[model samples]
Target: MNIIIWNCRGVLKPSFKKRVGDLVQNHNPAILVVMETRVGGDKAREITNLLPFDGAIHTNTIGYAGGLWVLWNTDRVEIALLSKTEQEIHTEVKVRLTNLSWILSAVYASPRNAERQVLWENLMSVADLHNMPWVIAGDFNEPLLSEDKFGGRAVSVNRSLLFKECLDKCNMLDIGFAGPRFTWSNRREVQALIQERIDRFFVNPSWCVMYPNAKITHLTRCHSDHCPVLLEMQPRIQNGRSRPFRF
Candidate 1:
């Protein structure tokens, strides 16, 4: 099964829609998690309608601050909206392969240090209570390591420490990449100022063990400052579905 996470910035422009459509067609993921939708109410509905997926769940921000949406292929997967806080949107879905249940958490952390800590703690609490395989993916807005950033800037000491603690507490693993070290870039004239990999995909240890062949696909960045991250899992054969007879 394939899962994709992207911060589209918003889905309002025609060009953005075209770009997203191209991505959906090329990847054809079973589940798609989108952040920073930047639209609410009817606009959200309209934007989701344009997606190739069968169904979508959207959590809109009050005045265009933070928004999230999840689009899933209904024919192959079952989706359930778990919970929504002021800072994140959570959902649980069952993939047709392995009949395995997985949680898809799309989060947009507050830039403020204190608020981010609270959000991270809340996420851990939820995971501990649920105790299921989860793929926590989104624009964390904070890089976990110095290598995750460019421009010779150092990773924030407090933020890095807090993020590491949160990952350890939640038993999550960071699936690193080899492509562009940064997922977001500053659109500036200065040659020195460039990028950082604030966006990430963190999965529970169980999920990692289950899908050992899983990989992160780095796609071209079209509309957002962050490039889309695709998590691809190896295909699993259903038990008792194949015959033992040799050809």
Candidate 2:
């Protein structure tokens, strides 16, 4: 199944919703995880009700700051909630067609640099129980290497080390991407434009064994500063061959 992970910045804008609808029409993602929705309660329902997905579990935004929403096509996948918090929606997702089940987490790390360590710890706690394959996607808010960024001030080595350390502790590997290198930008002029691969997916070895050909694609930035990213579990065919990866 294909899954989409994006930081929409905010979804209250009709223009933004129109772009999302366009994506829905073209990609037809089985599951969608949106970060930073910035809407809650009746206002959130007023908006997401328009989506094509039949099932959804979303955390309300806090004073226009942060929100996380996970939407799925019930016919394609069965979702059983595991645990939830403002930063994560952890669940067991089973594909109806293949009878394959695994752990999926749509997590949004805190934007504040100082508070992110706690978020990493929370994720590690989840990773500790490693019975099934797991795919974690979201805006991690930290980069693993200097090369993951573009046209910005250099990323601190300390920050990168911290993030890398956490991923190591959890036995996570960065999934490969097929499109643009960066998923977020400042939308400024040439000298001022800053881009970074802040949003992505990380999988454990079990995931590689399950779908060895899986690949991620980065969609163009539409109305939001962040671009939509899709994880193609059943890899797209090219030249009558599936992309190969080493576990």
Candidate 3:
């Protein structure tokens, strides 16, 4: 089944709404995961209603940070929000065609290294508990290597070795670079030269093996500094295709 993951920045803006509508019409994924929603309570509900499917939202108290959302086509999938903590939100959904359960962890890690460590630990714990086919996709806010950045002195403190190690321990595979290579930009002259693959998609081995045809799709940039990332997957087979009987 097709699944898309994007750090929408925030869906409250008019530009974002138009972009989202165009995206939904163009790709029509079975599942959609959004990070940094920046909307809470009633505003969150309003955003959900605007999407093409049924969804749930997790919002933070401080307004513009830590908010996440998952939207899925109600007709073909069943979704349940598994858990949510201060840093991340976990969701599990069953695809009707495959009968295989899929778990999605949409995250927004704080830029500070200390806070990120705590968040990484919490995410790892949840993954261990579930122990199923899953994907962790969002703006990690940390780059894996110096190659991931454009023109800045590789800040040793900024790299997320612990986070990368945690994924390795969990046996998840990074989906690798999809398009443009960079998801975030500084937008300033010299700083604009700074770009990195801070956003990524990691999947459990089981899911990758099961859906061998799955891929990540990079879409055009909207109003946000980050561009949207989509996961396109082939429909799961329930039974072997039948050959036509020749007359």
Among these predictions, the greatest lDDT belongs to 2
* lDDT, model 3: 0.72
* TM-score of candidate 3 against the unseen true structure: 0.87
Q: Supply candidate 2's per-residue lDDT for 96.
A: 97
Quickly count the clashes in candidate 3.
0
> Which of 1 and 3 is ahead in TM-score?
1
Query: Which one wins by TM-score: 2 or 3?
Result: 2
Scanning candidate 2 in windows of ten residues, the lowest lDDT window is 238-247
Writing each residue's lDDT as its tens digit, candidate 1 over 1-247 gives 7778888787775677777777778877888888887787888887778778888887767487777777888888998888876567788888775688878787877667788888889887886777788788888888887877877468888888888888777778765553566788886656767688877788887777777767776777877877998777763432222211110
Tens digits of per-residue lDDT for model 2, 127-204? 887668988889988766788888878998988888887787777877578789988888899899888898989888
Count of clashes, each model: 0, 0, 0
Every model: Cα RMSD to truth: 6.9, 2.2, 7.2
Off by over 4 Å in 1: 190-192, 235-247
Q: Model 1, residue 226: displacement in angstroms?
A: 1.3
Candidate 1, residue 121: Cα displacement in angstroms equals: 1.5
Instruction: Arrange candidates by TM-score, descending.
Output: 2, 1, 3
Q: What is the TM-score of each candidate against the true structure?
A: 0.89, 0.93, 0.87
